[model samples]
Target: MSETKTTVFRDLLAATKDGDWGKGESRQGHVPAYVIRGTDFAEVRRGCIAGVPIRYLAEKTVHRRLLRADDILIETAGGSRDRPTGRTVLISQEILDAFPGDVTCASFARFLRVDPVAASPRYVYWYLQYLYARGDMWTHQVQHTGVARFQFTRFAGTEEVPLPVRAEQDAIAAVLGALDDKIAVNERIATTADSMCDLIFQSRAQQHASVPMSRLLHPILGGTPDRKNESYWGGSVPWASAKDVVNATVGVLASTEEHITETATQNSRAKTLRPGSVVLTARGTVGAVARMVMPAAINQSCYAFEPGRMPAAVLFHMVRSAAKSMLGMAHGTVFSTVNMKTFDHVEIPNLPADVLNTLNGELASLHQLIVSHLQESRQLATLRDTLLPQLMSGRLRVKDAEKIAEEAT
Candidate 1:
């Protein structure tokens, strides 16, 4: 094994600074610039990074703070009990090319540019990911009030990291990066398939008759079993919330963070939705939709729709297309929310039986392809995650890890 040395986090960084805190007025007349938020950081995969459509700022002010290809982003604030603070991701050249516009992260995140002479940024990123997976990042977090904050200065000044030679770092990074690259390719394939399906559905929607959602589908509101009751939680039944729907990129929810007992389902309004039922977020993040791939109970924030005549695939898009209007219906001062009444009144395109069948036949294969890609990506991610700690800690050699990764891909 090559000799490895320990170094402080700050010594490896050329620069470290918090992102722009200014929430300037929207780019009404100015050029559009992308702004990364903490939520965006949370949404991305553990070792990957990408911007999300959350907020925009004036290009003039944000141009100075734009992220470079070598920069690393760390979530400084905002984390749940389950997900502790100090989540990190690496910005790559490919990401910069994808969004060519001026891009800067929001106030809740900090950016660190690694010193090329001192460390390989990709190696540092993978190490951070490994630390997070092992729950070591939590030891550097400080919880006050209710929010968990990453102790940036303390972490940077005192935290020790294993520093190998640059060549070894690059080799380790390459092994892990290969798995991520494959996952990225699969993600793009799934995204393209979904977009194609949506375009096809839009064209057919024009020829279909319109009917109120109440008439076309049966709506079942979700319920939460009392959190205080120990018996109500942790059973065989998978219980989904808005967060689960948000994470379900394929529009087919396969798993959830929390599970509920059968007794809880019977006691509450939460019903075990059958496979093919369309699940829609009716509160908080309105109109976020996913199809149930397995039997699961949903929380009060969601609505499960049993297809009357429409296929689940078509119904998923229908709700998705209506998301903007559904968001507009949200009425609350504390939190934006929509209810069953709003969905009941909303109208959706009603295709004839033959047309529905034909569309389903054409689109079903595309949907299946997407699901397959997502499943494959998940498996690859698991493998990459398993190898991360071993490679970083020198438990596995870079050449051996590379061979294993190549075979997996």
Candidate 2:
């Protein structure tokens, strides 16, 4: 039997300096740097670019270091106690260039430099990813600490990584990288879908005179059941919040983080959200929007629009165009809240039925394309995840993997 070798990560890697990567200035004159935290990955993947300053980094302390193309960034803390810690991201040249100087990572994020001689950078990337696969380990580790967090000392010092021969590492990394390459292709398809939708919306909005959102559609407020009632949750109905609506790129709204019982649905102000309902975030996320492709339920934080005269697709277009101005309606000293009155005041240029239908058809087609790519990406991810541990631990042969991948196509 081959014996397992133990090694300290400190011995295997060098440390990072303060300037290795710095946070960008909060603001450039009146503009602010778009700082992306761990949770911002999806949004960043969306229309939000890396350096487009929504907020300024100028007032905050600015560091001078920059992240390298090959460096690995780990999020040491985030999310709930039951969730995992130490989310790692491989920094790329594109990300580095976009988020230039004063562009900094959080203090909790640690940068690691792997020795190329012992392990390939790509190999290290896959290996570190596999270690965090369980995710439960982090929850258990931080259980006693009260707050869930990824402490650098505990993570780097204690985690036992399976180190193999350099050649073996290269082979494993290659297989995983190929899978990622396919996923990237799918992502481009998703991007194209987004671009197509953007073109239609922009063209229509520019041609029509901007009006208050109220002229577009009828508003139906969502409601939440009493949480104290056990029957209020854990049923089949998807009880959506601002977070769910904001993430959806397609017309479909199938599920949510929480669910509600039939009894709860009957008791609360919550209504059965049908397919074609235009859901808009009224609180928390504020003006974010999504269209329901399936029957679901939404919480008080979001508003559902059931089209009266306009087709569901046309209403979606109108809502998307008015999102920015509608968000501005809500004002608060601490937290922002959007009332129905505010939504009633917003408007969109009314288009002829034929024109609205044409535009709606184009958008629906684009959304369908995006959803297809998204499904493909999900499948590729699942395959990569399934093979990750096997490849890393020598259970799967690289040659066999190549054959399987070829056959998959």
Candidate 2 wrong stretches, greater than 4 Å: 1-6, 17-36, 41-64, 97-104, 136-148, 209-211, 249-255, 393-395, 400-409
Residue lDDT tens for model 2, 102-147: 3445454556767776557777777778877856346424545555
- Per-candidate clashes, comma-separated: 0, 27
lDDT of 1 by residue, 1-409 (tens): 3889989989999877787755455556455556677777644543234546435555466666778997888999888878888888778877766664766777889888999889899999988888889998787889876778888898888889898888999999898988988988888788889989999988998877777767777778899999999999999899999999988875768889999999998999887888877888877766788888789999999888875577777777777776656776676767777776776767778888888888887788898899889898889999998999889888999989988998988
TM-score of each: 0.91, 0.82
Point to the candidate with the largest lDDT.
1
CA lDDT of every candidate: 0.81, 0.67
Residue 275, candidate 2: how far off, in angstroms? 2.9
Query: Considering summed lDDT, which 10 consecutive residues are worst modelled in model 1?
Result: 42-51
**Candidate 2 total steric clashes:** 27
Ten contiguous residues minimizing lDDT sum, candidate 2: 17-26
- Evaluate model 2: give its lDDT: 0.67
